[model samples]
Structures are given as C-alpha cells and as structure tokens.
Target: MLSDLQRETRDEEIWKIKILSEMQRLKISFYFWREKTNNNLSYTSLMGPDKLKILKEFDLSAVFQSKTRAEQIRALWNQFYKLYLLMQNKTTTKKIFCHESQAWLDAFLAPSTGHPNKNNFVRGMYRTQDVTPYIHVLVNHVGEFLEIHQEFGLAAFSCSAVEKKNHMQVCLYFQNTLKDGGHENSQKSAILEMLEHENQQLYFALNETPNFFEAPKKFRLE
Candidate 1:
C-alpha cells in the first residue's frame, strides 16, 4: 500500500497521463498548485494546479504552457518523468538495465504489463554504453503506443564518485518516459510555430530521465 503522500504522488502521475491525453471535445487547463514541503530541488516534473499548489507550498514552482492539444500531450509526458525521479533513490553503481537492475524494477512494473520484453505487447530491455562506471541506460516502452497516450521509456547512469576508485560507484537510474503524446513529424508547422520554450519537448525528455542523488523524502520535500 502506498502512503498518503505516495498515494498523492500516484494521483499526480495518473492525472498528468489522463489530462494530457487531449480529447477532441474536452479542453483541460493545467497549473502548478503547491506542496506542503519547501525543498526546491526534490522534484523533476508534475502537472495540475492542485499538484503545483502542493509543490509551491514548499517553494517549488511548477508550470506548463501549450497552445495546441499536441503540446499538452507532451506536457503530460514531461511531468511523469519528473515526478517519478523525485520519488526514487540512487544507491549502487551496478550496470543499469542489467538482470539485477531489472529485477528491482520488475517488482513494481510487472503488475501493469506482465513484465517488459523485447517484443510487441511487451517491451525489450537492454543497456547501452552511454557513460563510464559501467553506466547503462535502461529503455522500456520504446515502441508501444496508444492512440491518445504517450509511450514510456527509462534510463539509468552511475554517479561519478570522488576517488574515481576502480571500485564501483553507486548509480541512479531513470525509469519512465511518456512519449505517445508526441505529435507526428508531419505536424512540423505547428511544432515549429509553437512558442520556443513552450514548444520544445526537451523538458519532456529531461523530466522523463530520472536524476538520482542523495536527498530526503521524509515529508515530500520540505
């Protein structure tokens, strides 16, 4: 069972996924509300005025802007990535996406999709030479897509330690990226014409890729 705060976080992630799934008929507006904590560095992304309000209570300003529904889709994907990272912790420098790493995540992920694989109706898992310390980025949900939802992806990296010790340094891996809300390549006009900061989905990518570091989550970042 999730704690009260964890439950709230789950709600926040779910709402982001839902509201961003633009409906041709229902137009939804999202805003940053506030949070009870005052830790500014604890969060990666979030959507909804209520969640923003919760974040703001802790001095974290969360906001998103989009002119078209496509942008809104991107925004939703962005928030989930940020929120998940804010909640997870980094502890080891083992190969990310390796059998061991996947084991830990599978416990949490399997309930949803019967565990990821490298095929359709399933996602394949693997690592790439993205960095040193044996760092590997785990990618899942690379191809699955629904009509109105974003496909998700995950990655992990090892934190550079002080000694550069031949010994292993702990790693913080990012899990979960929402991309289905992405607009088609042909929608180039709208994407190019959209507001630069608001238009670029880079933040979407940033928030999706979880950053692991030593932090306290006692009261949701106060």
Candidate 2:
C-alpha cells in the first residue's frame, strides 16, 4: 500500500483524471497520457461514448463527424463560463477557452452537456511533446488552470463567472454562445468530485509530438 504522502499524491492524480474525464465529457478537444509501470503506456479519447448513445437515443445523426462535435462543445462551455462569472461577482469580456489548459481544458470542456458518469470520446492522437499539452494533479486547481493556458494557443482565455450553489463556490467557464458538440450531460457535483478528488494526480505534461488531425478531402455534411 502507498504511504500517506504517496496516497495523497495518488489521490491527487485520480482527481486530475476525473477532471480530464470531465473535459472530455464537456466535449473539449484534447488527448492525454500516463506513466504506466515503465512500459505499458497508453492514450485515449474524451468525447464520451454516451454522446453516441445519446445520438442514437435521440436520433441525432449530425453529430457523427469530429469537427462538428468540437464546435458544439466550444459553444456550451462559453455559457458555463458566463454563469461562473456571475457567481464570482467578476466582470470581464475575455472568454475561458483562451485561458484553459491543454489537454485538461480540452477535456474539462469536452463534454457537450456536462453530464457526469458519461464517456466524452474525446478525439485526437497522443504523443510526447514538451510545452504542447500541459500537466498537473489535484489540490492545485489554480495552478492547473494556469498550466493549461501556458500552452501553445490558449493564453487568451479569460476566467469569467463563478458557479454558486448551496453556498458553495465553483469557479467555472460555461461557454454557451457557440453551438458545436452533439449532446451531453450537466452533472456539476459529479464534475466537481472528479476534478477535486477522482481524477487528481493525473498530469498533462509536455510531449515530444503534438497530436494532429487530418482534413477530409470531400464534403458530406448531409
């Protein structure tokens, strides 16, 4: 078993994972990695399978493409950001995406509807690229936030509103202006628990190479 400090560290990583998962659930476009037992490295998507299930459940055929999903998510997160601002009693024209972290931000805002207990199925590849995707764990929400924006093109993110419920303060970035992702969830508590406890210690450190996407030669948005 791990010691107190070790357990604490591990727990932190768990919370980070939860947060990453949340980003994925939010439909944030990002990828991640982990230091397995030395040789068992792996990477995965964040778009959440439930999204597909949701599409099937509601007969949503338009969300099958990757880019479409990305756009939808960007919009929802904007709304969440606005609400977060109201709770914080802060006023700013800047948006949240510009300041969000690399994979973390992508994953945090990945979910289209913030639905907890759902798989976001985040698209994108994974690799080792320093300064590409940021890194972090739990107990350092602010640091984590900073780390994300430190990456390539996210330095313009602006923390807007604060989420207040039951007297609890949750600094948020609910982007609602744009309509991109297909459809997702909105479980605030679940997302909170994941970011603060479950997915902590999960670092989104730098990689040698950044995940890239390929453009389709033909148009088929029917």
TM-score of each: 0.18, 0.18
The lDDT of each candidate is: 0.33, 0.37
Q: Please give, for residues 68-100, the per-residue lDDT of candidate 2 as tens digits.
A: 443444443454343344323322212333343
Candidate whose TM-score is highest: 2
For residues 138-185, what per-residue lDDT tens digits would candidate 1 score against the true structure? 323211111112222222323345435323111211112122233576
